[model samples]
Target: MNYDIFNGDADGIISLLQLRLANPVESKLVTGVKRDIGLLGKLTEKVGLSKTDKITVLDISMEKNQTGLVKVLDAGVDVFYADHHRAGEIPTSKHLDAHIDLDADTCTALIIDKLLDGQFHYWAITAAYGDNLIAKGDKLSNLAGLSVELSEQLKELGTLINYNGYGAIVEDLHFHPAVLYTALLKYASPFDVIADNSSPFYRLQNAYQEDMASALAIKPDHQSDKLSIFELPNEPWARRISGVYGNQLANQNPKSAHAVLTENRDGTYTVSLRAPLSNKQGAGDICSQFETGGGRAAAAGINALSKEQIGDFIKAVEAFY
Candidate 1:
């Protein structure tokens, strides 16, 4: 048995799409929600790798999944990992091959496409757009045969799908991202998703638009010259829409950094930060002040914050700006 382990988001799906196109492997897909990574162990349980069984781990990292990865390699599985996450202390297993670049500009999907000489460039662009690599997506879009208008629409789909995968759980989203990925898995190009009338990708796109409209009903927290923080209550709609809301706020008002927080079901919160595209990038620094997260200049996330720290995060953002 062969396995394709992925992150269950745009990058992961598109990464697998690119690899499958190049290698044409009919492997079993092992994926879950965005947070359900470290999949190598799960695959190990399914098929304790013989010399014939193989695994492709996409958009997940040795850093985040070190323990699980070690278990899989120790079990004699042949695993290939492609990721863009920060990694440390490279493993010495002969059965493991890694393609990890923490470059903010290139995601895993794009990396695999590059490895395959861009055989499936459209999916690469979709993954880039979904990851909110806006400038990179624009360039990739131009190369992928999208007219300007269609390119923007596909970008919307990517952003929407990425945004929905956010939230603490599936109940927070209009649709589970696993379901969305199932809808998208058959297509080689995102355009194929839009072009196929029978495809549910368009339906997912429409649902996201409606949900984004609902999330935007709230106003900015404080619209300073440098930052805009939008707070979302612990509601399903708000959680479904937080990531897109953050990106929308950042894109529509590029001069200001944006923080979009969704209060979680447990009364904590998850934050999506899209810092100003300018030079004053302090997102990772601020997020590291708490126990929750660390990310790049333009985009980042904080997984969970205690109720008390919620106030501190708000106060810290003021200092960050």
Candidate 2:
């Protein structure tokens, strides 16, 4: 059997979309909420693997899934892995094909775009937008000769799709990432998804507006010249909008680092950290200092940050840039 394991966010979902659209496949889908990066482990825990099984893993950090990956490879399962996150040490195995690029500007979908020679270029561009590589998305769209209006449409679609991926759990999301992927597979191009009024694009748009409105109503928990911090309550909407809200804040205040912290049920905070748009270099480094943190230079996140360390996190960001 073929198993498709991917991150539930826009980058991972759209990366697999481009590949499947180019080369149709029958595979068991494996995905979860946006923060559920330990996907290979879930697959191993849920079902036994076989020597004949083939797996495609996307977006999630290889280092996080290293143990599960080794197990699959030892069982003779062929794996195709692609991502932009930190990969500690890549395994050397004929059964594994890994395409990993740590460039801050690149994403998995864009990596697949180059591999497929841009067979699904528009989708890749949309994924770039969804991943918040805004400038890169616009540049690619222009190079593709897309009209400004069409490019805007792609951006909105990407943003909405990305928004749907957030949530403490899949149940909090309007559509599970696997279901969203299935729904999107029917459309040959992203434009078609936008053209279809019944597509998840429309549903996500409505849901996104509601969540963003609630988030916007909350005042920043802490604010200063160097950084700003917003603490969201432990609600489904808060979890759904934390990452996107952080992005919005960073864009609104280009010179200031921003952190959006969502209260978890356990009293810890799920933090989304964005370095100043004017200086997008230290976010990942700053976040990596925390035990539960790791991400790219432009944007990073901490899975669970202690309430006490909140002050320290703010100071670290301020000191970095």
Candidate 2 residue 60 Cα shift, in angstroms, is 0.3
lDDT of 2 by residue, 232-299 (tens): 99999999998888888888999999999999989999999988888878787898899999888888
Q: In candidate 1, which residue pairs get closer than 3 Å at backbone N, Cα or C atoms, i.e. clash? A: none
In model 2, the runs with Cα more than 4 Å from the true position are none
Candidate 1, residues 11-82, lDDT tens digits: the string is 887787777756776667787656555577666666656766777888875666787788777777788989
TM-score of each: 0.87, 0.97
Q: After superposition, which runs of candidate 1 have C-alpha atoms over 4 Å from their true positions?
A: 41-52, 143-145, 171-179, 280-289, 294-297, 314-321
Q: After superposition, how far is residue 313 of candidate 1 from its true place, in Å?
A: 2.6
**Model 2's lDDT to the true fold?**
0.91
Give candidate 1's TM-score.
Answer: 0.87
